[model samples]
Target chain A: MIKQILNDIDQNQAEIIAGLRKLIEMESSDGKATKAQEFVLKELKEMGFMTECFREDERSSSQVDYSPNRF
Target chain B: MNEVHLKWIIPPTDFEYHPEAYNVAGTIKGKGTVPSLMLFSHIDTEAENYFGKFENPYQSTIHDGKIIGLGASDDKGGVAMMLYAVKTLLKYVPQLPYDLCVMSILGKHGGGFGTLSALMKGYTGENSIYLHPAETGHGFAEIKNISLGVVDLDISVKGKPGKLHDDLSEGVNAAVLISYLVTYLEKYNQQMRDKNRFDFGSFKGEPSFILNVGTIEAKGGYGGINQRAKCCVRIRFYKPLTIEGVVEDLSKYLKECCEKEGKVNFADVIIERGSFRATPAQVETEDPFVQLIEKKITDVTGIHQFIHQYHGGSDIRLPMLYGKSHCVGIGPACALPQQNSGQMEWISIDDYINGVKILASILFEYCNFDQK
Candidate 1:
């Protein structure tokens, strides 16, 4: 079953390459990752997965976040 | 004397190519050549937290017996010390048994780009040291080793979407699921600390190793249910727990939690890797070169110095990876300066001058100036 999944992805190599190029061209920086994320969400939706997006200010996820001061 | 130029592999959008960054190095020849000793310092500063935004990041001033500037402590101070030490030593000694080289490198902050380039160009040495700021018991300290490694990852979790009015059993909440993983990992890290697995040698601090979920975002309105969420995590770790090891544990944990019978349902979780394999580097405490450094610092400062592992990594780690010499870190700073925080950073003028003295003493002692 895993082999079949791998083979299917390999067969669609051209589509994968095109999608990667589109993402690279988008030039995501700062908080602009969301703009590129929309492209990913669109692809996921077309593949029949439901999706929703969020940003940093969304307080719902802050409680579970861990912030380290040092790099 | 040679100036090394590095052309950028990936140029910024506005320009075709940036001016070649350079590494400056000079060496003083010895009378009876045997092996060489090297001193290294970075020439670059963390210019901006985020680029394309305007801020007076470079303005500097002198205040309270200190030099205040952006890269004051981070490296420009060390650079000054290295050059002055060389000039004084050349004027006084004129000849030695082993050649002494002073190097100033670029790209120490971004990655070990300049150091790695110098290594590729064969600028390594037999015995080496680096100057970086660290808090010491006295006004100076040397690092036993630096064992901190880093990884940044982006993860997305997906589940079936359901209406808000529906019962909780109808769909999986990404927020809840991610929280579970976070809690588990936190406990795991604490357990590791308890077992002394996160040992920091002589360095003293709380949470010697850290795992941080820097940012997380989940979508869900009061009346609408969301099916996806994303998070970014950064982990700094010590030896025996590498980036790959952490990722492997995470993968195994996810499988055990979700794939078992009667578990919470999630269609898939994807992990996007960033800086996945930057490992830590260190030198043994008992090496002869290290012992000599300890003796020299003690003799010059007349204060007992401490040998400890640094919590952070630096370009000094690059030499150790090449296995050419025993690399150690020593610098003259009473306290570490603030970096990357748009604030005026400073290095003590006394400490800076003393640093030059300490380095000169070490170079003179290590090269056996008495014989000359």
Candidate 2:
């Protein structure tokens, strides 16, 4: 089973690299992964996966803050 | 003298957080067979321009069979592998037996809040693997079962404008004062390195703890002497050293140093613990989930998977700390800074594809999907 899976992945290697390029070039270092995520959202949506967006705000997802210390 | 007249130092915070990052999760529903699994990677990249500036950090330049860009190896490669591995799984076996969650969170070197948000939003699984390529340069051959604790410290010394002074007890040069503190810190760091040294694993023969002075800042232009100077020190320590425990020991050490200096009060030297402030974590290497992945790695790459207890902080610690999930980290091959110059961060193309292949196999078994 694993061997077959590996073979199939070998075939998709080109597409995988392409997608990776698109993601890397989009630039998300500033924490606003808007462009890169748009690509992700599109890809997942096409795959029939359940997708959701969560952003940092005062109201949502702030209850447990495992924050990094910074200046 | 350039000795500083004591002002005050702000103590360190427990940790830090980001405000504008995003956490995106895509899930393929499972058949309620067994506990669900998650493959996670961070999206955000850091400008770790330690050696030199990474020109066009996001350009996605490919050279000599490797892709060079910021986050290329650290996680972007992992993200790509996870994303495509899921695609391969669904293409080969659509009816997955268990849930598979793929997450791309803002796990910047800034820390784990992006992941914390997802867990809080209830997007976690019982078994989680963070896919971040090894900086150990061992490529996909090693697995991270251990994560180091971190405490980022900000040491600031108040500056006072002044001309040249030869022990005249006049204006305070913050830079000079900080230089003095650096000597103490260096001596102390050497002591730290001597204890808890490692004999095996990825960082063999090196100290389990590392205190690196990453950055120092003061006014740059003219008349800048009066401005406050600050130094950012990062400490990555191994187990048996809790963040608070390290903090207590370090605070005491600094207090003692300052009092002995006498020219500066410990109050005048503020060392703030800014980031990470996390504890070391270990997921059993013998965990069934990890065993399954390791077996798949060997089957896919034909390399004996060496489990490396990373002496550094990672998001794998996130799930263990917050969600109590078992964790392991696997990824492709990438070079570390100072090893790969100009284009500091990059991933090997062939290794990355194989990483995807290995992950695909893991997901198939993880989802209870049978051979077609």
Candidate 3:
């Protein structure tokens, strides 16, 4: 089992790099990880897992544009 | 939301938070034999604050066998690793005796918002792994089981509000008075560093607590001094020091210093605390699940070490705090592509592949009740 798991990861080098690439390009910052989270949920669904998303709380526009100066 | 997190520390919330955003999680059910295992990492990062530092922060590039991007080493690598580990695990150990949960929570930007929400929503496991790279820059060679606490506050000195046309030196400049306090605080910070030293694997007598003055400004914007001269303060501390204790202690020292110096009116000095107060959390290294991960790490990469973290403010704290789980953090060999070369951070493709192997091994054995 150990060998199989290791071999599986080893053989999927291109796919691993591609996976990291996708996440890096998604740009999930400022509490906006929706795109990246969707991608991850899709991957898990492919793996046959029961996936779901937790919605964030509503925030004000000023709160969204928050920076150190505002604090 | 802003009340619970900081502008920078619990932070990452420094940027305006997106409304109606979601934290995604995946779970696989299993027989009621062993406790479940969870894989968690934040998906959000600080905004493109490094705007001019790198060529393209968003683009992932490869150089000398390293994958580089804005958040690659910071945590995107860990997020990818968790995804692939689960993908491979389902193929190798499809018959897990216990459940498996994988989460991509919003990270520091929300000031631990996503993780705290998940924990409150009762989405946790008996054994959890926070998939974040060790800030020590040691990658998978290190694992963090400790969550360092932090205190975030602002300290400022008030001055006479200058007129729009007032010359630069008309009023007792708040900026000038604040400068003296800043110098004193720097010295005091050094002393605190000396007192909070730690000796971990390959971390020989290093200061575990780092007190950083993240930002300082006069709010005058190239004009004369404004009504207040302020700076943001963050202290990452170890156990036995509560946030209130640190705040009260530091406040007292600063007040005494101002009184003794009599440079500026003592009343003018203002120390306003923020809401981002985080407490430390830890799970014993001797816990079977942690040892199992350490063993699998050795089994896969022939490298092992108990790398306790000196700074903390991430998803690593949630499981131990809310789930009562044995948690340890492990990630790829993530670091900067070059040392101070104005380049994006990176993670070794080899180390990343090896990390996948390690996580897969840990998952298989930890959930494989057949072994017991």
The numbered model that scores best in DockQ is 2
- DockQ-based ranking: 2, 3, 1
- Judge candidate 2 at residue B201 and give its lDDT: 60
- Tens-digit per-residue lDDT, B113-193, candidate 2: 567678767888788989987766777677888878777777888755555532225667677677777777887788889
Global lDDT of each model?
0.54, 0.72, 0.72
- Which CAPRI quality tier does the interface of model 3 achieve? acceptable
Backbone clashes in model 3: 7
Q: Please give the distance, in angstroms, between residue B216's alpha carbon in candidate 3 and its true position after superposition.
A: 2.5
Leading candidate by lDDT: 2
Please tell me which predicted candidate would have the highest TM-score against the true structure. Answer: 3
Give the proportion of true interface contacts each model preserves, from 0 to 1. 0.00, 0.52, 0.68
Indicate whether candidate 2 or candidate 3 has the larger TM-score. Answer: 3
Candidate 2 residue-wise lDDT, A1-71, digit = tens: 66777887787777888878888888676555767777777878888789988875432221233233310
lDDT of 1 at B15: 13
Better of 1 and 2 by DockQ: 2
